[model samples]
Target: MKKQILTTPDGESYPILTGTGLLETCGQEIAALTAPCRAMIVSDSNVAPLYLEKVVNSLKLAGFEVHTHVVSPGENSKSIAVFGALLESFAEAHLTRTDIAVALGGGVIGDLTGFAAGCYLRGIRFVQIPTTLLSAVDASVGGKTAINLQHGKNLAGMFHQPAAVYCDINTLKSLTPHELADGAAEAIKTGILGDPELFAIYETGDPENDAEEIISRAVAYKSKIVTEDPQEHGVRKLLNLGHTAAHAIELLSNFAISHGHAVAIGTAIVTRAAVKRGIMKNDEGTRIINTLKRNHLPTDSAFTAKELSKIATLDKKAAAKDITVIIPETIGRCRMEKIPISALEGLFADGLGEQV
Candidate 1:
């Protein structure tokens, strides 16, 4: 197994382990980080059926009293109500500060379980076992944990770092093509932001043959950035490259659009706007849209600029009267653009094109 240790600016550190069959050793990893005790394995209906028993057995083998709680799958489960319910489960399971909470599913499971761990008895240890590619590369490594509110996605959350992260590439084999493509959007974003070579992997590398390296590299890039700006007070904001408009599209669609697809569209829109303003070369814009298209990700949204603009105002990235966005200044580089709220409609309108 290959390991990457993520250290935050404040000197906090955790290990992210990636390789085939890493999940079976999760209990030993967690035991080494903290004492052997009760662990609440929080997962969703979708994931629990597949891997929960194996994880529970691993923890039990390591002398941990394991308890499992499974929620219904999907974004809706990442709610305050579910979070509250999980907290009750923790209390019922008698989990203490020494006992850890293990997130055994995808991003939704990680976020909700992490938040509960953060709030329960003030705070408790937690570990991440991200099953989906999206969570493996992006959500699981960073300490950013949250549940959506009626207002916006991840409107409420905490910077609760996990004790360790287990990203078993073997788990990715079960992912559908759409699920795999969902993660490609984030990988593409990572490449565009800092690693042109990584970007080329999308264009040239075979995902089935190169999945491990791609996930490791993407996690490494994100780990470096998160370590530098854990709370997103500075460079960390750059990580939200296409998220500003992406979140808006998700909300406007009532979440019919998944986060990754919305981000694909958002990246396309930002590049289009950048190209129009001469901040990005037309070829760079074309490359991004083409890369997303090649991955089967959507680069256009049906939502109008006016509708998106209204929702964009509610995005967490938006400040008093303007929303700060990360725009690609060139391939492998980006700059922040804090656009006035009133002008957002025009920006989206200008960026909108038939790339579907």
Candidate 2:
């Protein structure tokens, strides 16, 4: 397995290993996290069927008592109702804190399960086996777990770190073109946050063909930031490059647009906005736009400027006096500029690709 040890914000180190056919190793891998006891895996409907049995078989073969709970897949399933059902499943089986919660799906499943584990018994252990590329590269490693609320995506959540995370690249073979595009947008965002050379790699590399190397780089990039600041206090803030506007688009669409695609559009907007703000160069912004388009993600969407502005006001990155904005100076370097709400109008206009 390809391995990297990441130290999250609270100074905790966890392993994120990537490779083909690594799902079978979940037993020996997670056995080191804790004792080989009862591990309750929370998964989604679609993905669980494809690989859940294999994971359970591996654990059971390795002498672990494994319990599995499968819920309907998609962001729509990330709700309080699902959490209640998951907890109910755990309670019915008489699981305890001594046991573990293993999340085995995409971002939705990982976040939902991780949040449940965070609250269960005042914080038990969790091992993330992220199936989707988006989860593998970003969602799984960060420890930012949350289910969506009526108001927004990831608005309801907690800072719950998992015991460890496993990224099985083989599972990604099932992705459709749209799904793969979502993951590519995130990889591009990582570049927008902190690596021009890495960003350049995507410029020439074909997402249709270079899935393995691209996923690895994205995972490695996220690990570097998450290891330093697990919490979004400083360096972690850079990771939010497209997230600010992306979350708005997700909410405005009622989540019709996939998270990664919204993020790709969000990235394009911010890159354009920064250029208009005179901080980011024109060439760099063009690179970001072309990248998004090349990946088959949206470069622009039709959310009114008024609605987006209001959503931005409620973002986690926004506070009483200022809001933190992630702007790329080049490819690998993104810095946070805390600016007043009043100063945002011009940039917003520019971000919409509307010239002053």
Candidate 3:
């Protein structure tokens, strides 16, 4: 297993392990961290049948009192109702602050479970066992845990770091091509923010063959950023590179479009506008769009500029009358630009290649 350590500014730290067959030894790893206390494995309907038993058995073998809570899989599960149900499950399980909650699925499972773990008993420890590529490279590392509100996505959440993260690349083999592509969007976004070599991997390398390396690099990059600004008060905002417009697209689609696809569209929009405005070179913009397309990700959305700006202004990143957007100056560099809410529509127009 390839391992990376993420240390926060406050000195709290966790290990992120990525490799094949890590799931089988998950219990042992958790045991090493704590005294084999009670562990609640929170999964989704889709993943429970596939890997829940393995994790449960592993935790049991490691002397942990294991319990399981499975929920329906989807973005819909990331709601207040589901979060309340999960907290109730924690209470019912009698999980103490010392005990850990294990998230055993994709980003939704990780986010919901992490948020629940953070809220239960004033906060208990949690472990992330990400099953999808997107969660492995993105959600599993960041301490940001949130549930979507009726108003927008991730409007309700907190910074609750996990005790450990086990990303078994083997689980990714069970994913469909579309699901795999879903993750590529985040990986590409990471490359855009920083790491030119990682960006090149998507441009010319075989992602499937380089899964371990890709996860390792992406985790390392995010780990560095999170460590620098654990609370997202500073440089950490760079991580929101494509997420501003992406969230708007998701809300507009009523979540018919997946997060990664929305990110692909959002990244393309931002890069297109950056190029047109001379913030980024035309060649770099073309490379980004082409890379997303190469991975079967979308570069455009059906939502009009006016429609996107309306929803985007309501984003959590909005402060007073300004919203901070991460604009790419080049392939491996990005900067935060705070634009007035009124200008957001024109920015979207520029990105959409429409006259503003």
Candidate 4:
């Protein structure tokens, strides 16, 4: 196993373990997080049916008294109703602070379960077993947990880091082609933020998959970023590479764009504009669009400039005067800029001309 540990604001170390066959090794892994009071393996119906048993069994063998709860699958389920229902279930189980919850699916499980764990008993411990490429590369590592709102996606959430994240690439074998593409969006963003060499892994035009070395390198790439800024106060904001406009598109789409796809489109939109302003090379931005296209992901989504502006205004990153965005002057470097909403409008418009 290739493992990287990140210490949080409270000095708690969270482990990100990347490899094949790491699923059944939960026994030894969860030891650091709890005293084995009780464990709830929260996941979605689709993922629960496939791997819940293996996960529960692993925890049981590790000496934890385990239980399972499965949510209906899809982005729509990330809401107040479902979250309320899950919280009730946790209370029914009488989970204590010593008890840990393991999110056993993709980003949805990680976000939903992480949020619940953050709130339950005033913040208990949880482990992330990210099964999809999108989750492993992005969502599962960061402490950002959120559910959608009537107005936008991920509007209600908190920054509660997990105890450990288990990234087993073998899980990607079950992803649909589109799902695989969704995760690659983040991998590409990793390159956009920094790591041209890591970005080149996709140049051969192969998809993100159970490739051992590639998965480990991607984990390493993100792990370094997470460590430098565990909380999104400074350098961590740079990790938002393609998310500024991505979130707006998500709001306009009614949360139709999966997290990765939204970011993919956002990257293309911003990169294109960055080229126009001499903030990025035109060819580098083109590379992003080509790579996303090769993976069969979106470099653009349908939305008017007006609606995009509305969502941008509502972004949590937006404050009194400016909206902070992480734009790459080029690969291997990113800077935070607080740009006016009007300026972002023109910048975003240019990327729509071409796909990344």
Candidate 5:
């Protein structure tokens, strides 16, 4: 397994392990970090039947009293009701501060389980066992855990770091091509924000053949940023590169559009706008759009610029009058720009190549 340690400035740290078959050893890996106490393995309906038993057996062997809680699979599960149900499961399982919660599915499972673990008993440790490529490269590393609110996605959440993260690449083999593309969007976003080498892989190489390297590099880049600005007070905001418009797209679609696909559209839109405003070169913008398209990610949305901008104004990133948008100056470099809410529509118009 390829391993990297993310150590925050406050001295909090966790290990992110990426490789094939890591799931089978997940319990021992987590055990090395925290004692093998009661573990509530939270998964989704889709993943439970496939790998839950393997994890449960491993944890049991490691001396952890294992319990399982499975929810329906999809973005809809990242709701207040699901979160409440998870917390109740924690309570029913008698999990304490010392016990750990294990998230054994995709990003939704990670976010839902991590948030519930953070809230139950005031706060408790959680371990991330990401089964999908998106969660492996993104959600599994960052301490940010949240549930979608009626108002928007991830409006209610906290930064509760996991004790450990086990990314078993083997699990990705079970994903559909579209699901893999969903993850490619985030990896592409990561490459554009930082890591030109990673960006090149997407442009000219096959990601399926380099999954371990991709996950490790993405995790390392994010770890460096998160370690520097754990609370997102500064550099960490760069991670939201395409998320502003992406969240708006998600909310507009009632999450019919998955997060990664929305981000693919959002990144394309932002890059298009940057090119229009001369903030980025036309060649770079074209490269980004082409790469997303090549990866089977959508670069255009069904929503209009006006609709997206209006919903984006209500985003959590918005302040009283302005919202911070991450604009790419070039691949491997991005800057956060705070624009007034009134100008958001114009920005979207530029991105859509419509008359502003």
Candidate 6:
């Protein structure tokens, strides 16, 4: 198994174990941690039948008293109601702070379970067994846990780091093409943020055969940023590169669009806006759009600027008068620009690569 240790800005550290067939070793890994005698496996309905039993058996063999909770799959499942229910499950199971929570699915499960762990008894240790490429490369390592609201995406969230993360490449085999594409969008985003070499791979490499290396590189990139700024108080905000507009796009569509698709469109819009402002060249914008298109991601939205602007105000990244918008300086670099909230509508209109 390949291992990477993530160190927080405060010097705290956790290990990310990446390799094929690491699910069977989850129990042993947990035992190597603080050794909680009790654990709760939080998974989604789509993943429960496939690998939940294997994880449970592994935990049991390692002498852990295990309880399980399976949530319905999809973005909708990451809700306050679901989060509340998971807390209730923890209470009913008599989980104490010493007990741990194991998130055994994709990005949704990791976010929901991590939020549950953070709030359960004011906070408890949680492990991330990210089954999706997106979670492994981005969401699982950040300590940013969130649930969506009716008004916008990730309106309610907290920063609670996991005790450990086990990225079992074996899980990728079961994912649908859409799932893989969804994750590739994030990896591409990481490449665009830094590491031009990584960006080159996304443009020309076969992701299926190179999943492990690509995921590891992305994780390492994010880990370095998180180490420098664990919170979004500074450099970390750059990680929101395509997310500002992406959240608005997701909300305006009532989440009919998946996050990866939304991000693709968001990045394209931001790139175009940068081009219009002469911040990024026209060729750079074309490269970003082509990359997204080549990856089977979307670069267009049907919503008008007025509709998306209203949703943008509710984004967690937005402040009372300004929203921190991330723009690409070039394909492999980006910068944060705090735009006045009043100008958001215009930015959205301009970002569409058309006249308002």
All models: lDDT?
Answer: 0.88, 0.81, 0.93, 0.80, 0.91, 0.87
| Candidates 1 and 4, the one with greater lDDT | 1
lDDT of 2 by residue, 96-153 (tens): 8788999999999999999989988888889899888788778888789998777667
Per-residue C-alpha lDDT of model 1 across residues 1-356, encoded as one tens digit per residue: 78999998778899999997777888888889887999999999888888998899999999999999999998998898999999999999999878999999888999999999999998998999999988987989889999999888999999999989998888888888888888889989999998887788887677657878888889988998898889998888988998878999889888889888898999999899889888999998899889899888999889887788889887887899887878898879999777798888887877885222
Off by over 4 Å in 6: none
TM-scores for all candidates: the values are 0.97, 0.95, 0.99, 0.94, 0.98, 0.97
Q: What does candidate 5 score on TM?
A: 0.98
Q: Which stretches of candidate 5 lie over 4 Å from their true place?
A: none
lDDT of model 1, residue 251: 90
> Candidate 4 lDDT, tens digit per residue, 1-356?
67777776567677888887777887667865666668989989888878888888888888888888999988887899998888888899999878888899999889999999999889988889999888888888868898877876788889888888888777888889888888888887886677776677775544454355555667777767667777677788888887878888877777767778888888887777788778888887777778878878787669755667677878877787777877778766778898887666666766665322
lDDT of 6 by residue, 116-224 (tens): 9999999999999999888888889979999987766777889999999999999988998788888888888988899777777778778778888888899999999
**Count of backbone clashes for each model?**
0, 6, 0, 1, 0, 0
CA error at residue 58 for candidate 2, angstroms: 0.8
Ranking under lDDT, best-scoring first? Answer: 3, 5, 1, 6, 2, 4
User: Candidate 6: how large is its RMSD?
Assistant: 1.2
> Where is model 1 more than 4 Å wrong at Cα?
353-356
Cα error of candidate 5 at position 71, Å: 0.3
TM-score of candidate 4 relative to the true fold: 0.94
Candidate 1 colliding pairs: none
Q: Model 2, residue 184: what's the lDDT? A: 80
